[model samples]
Target: MSGYAYVTAEGLKKLRAEVEQLERIERPSISRQIGEAIDKGDLSENAEYDAAKEAQGLLEAKISRLRGILANSRIIDETKIDTSKVQMMNKVTIKNQKNGAVMTYTLVSETEADFKQGKLSINTPIAKGLMGKLVGDVVEIQVPNGLIPFEIVDISL
Candidate 1:
């Protein structure tokens, strides 16, 4: 929350779009709902009004959080990324030493991580262990289950 979050230009654009949607569209819609609910009945007996107020609060909190993230975000230039070793935004191919299973993952910021797309958050234990490691290097990382060793196969931008 304090330090800068590294994000790609596309990720930053997505975040900005989300914030805009929440503020420009969702906020006014919630306000209209609150106004309609207020017209329904007494303050103490109105469930709709209460629900609308709660929803407004939650939406405001989300907007605040997203704004904070944007304030601290730093966009990473893809052209400046180094592929010599494991690093943020690098697509890394690794093999599980114990089972010989190979997998590839792109190390990315937490907001940009999509497991379905094979993007791993840099904060994850595996990505943390892989940081700064070169291809052919063997690394042992501790996970919830136990320690597992992985051999770095390749690194690419």
Candidate 2:
């Protein structure tokens, strides 16, 4: 899981911004909380000190994880993407053959996957099934409910 994470320029920028926010704002805030906790005497049974320490540990771990992702990330040029077939960063429109339901999703890297925004992770079952598939290609994908067939309606940038 420590391999390179290919991301769009915007995705990379967002990641960097999140990291900066955690480091510059969150880190100092946690430090201040710990310091204020220390101002209160008797650290042995201090709930505020314990809570602050726990929060700091969680934040540091999160920062470390994000840094690791950033270290291994590579920006993917959106202009170089192909539309002939399904691939990373491509917006794909698919139709469910069984239920005739049409849905569109933008296949993206793991870090940028947000289903609510129609961004899907390439590692997902639907995305995996759609990889390298051309428009009008029908693919049978195994989903949580059961196996469902989907036809590639369109592929775009």
Candidate 3:
């Protein structure tokens, strides 16, 4: 995708929803907690007020980070994805040369990655190694565990 971060419509929707939830729901909840802590009196020694302030800071930071990701990443057209070579939004199946273990992952932007759902970030070593490789092409990826060879079994939408 021309060295740009690409996110799917679903991912974009999720990010937007999260921002909404944070701003509308979580923000109000935290504000209420802070108000309650203040109403309890003695602000200088109030643990609840300090905890609420810390949580507010963390939540604001997270919201800002998520918004930045939303602003920087371009939404991908899923239907136009090419399977000619491994790239973003492509579901790729690979087989380990040494252990014979097969794994499938959909390459996506870092913001959209959910390893539990087989979404692998393009920034990862394995995804970087398979970036432009075609089916049947073997690639050696250097992960934290060390270099391991993998054969591209299939690439699909």
Q: TM-score of model 1 relative to the true fold?
A: 0.94
Candidate 2 C-alpha lDDT tens digits along 34-132:
999999989999999999999999999999998999999999988899999999999999999999999999999998999999999999999999999
lDDT of 1 by residue, 1-157 (tens): 6999999999999999999999999999999999999888798989989999999999999999999999999999999999999999999999999899999999999989999999999999999999999999999999897999999999997
Q: How far off is residue 41 in model 1, in Å?
A: 0.9
Q: Which has the greatest lDDT?
A: 1
Identify the superior model by lDDT, candidate 1 or candidate 3: 1
Q: Which residue pairs in candidate 2 have backbone atoms (N, alpha carbon, C) closer than 3 angstroms, thus clashing?
A: none
RMSD, model 1, all Cα superposed? Answer: 1.2
TM-score of each: 0.94, 0.94, 0.93
Lowest summed lDDT over 10 consecutive residues: which window, candidate 1?
37-46
Best-to-worst order by TM-score is: 2, 1, 3
Determine which window of 10 residues in candidate 3 has minimal summed lDDT. 1-10
Following a full C-alpha superposition, what root-mean-square deviation does model 2 have from the true structure?
A: 1.2
Best-to-worst order by lDDT is 1, 2, 3
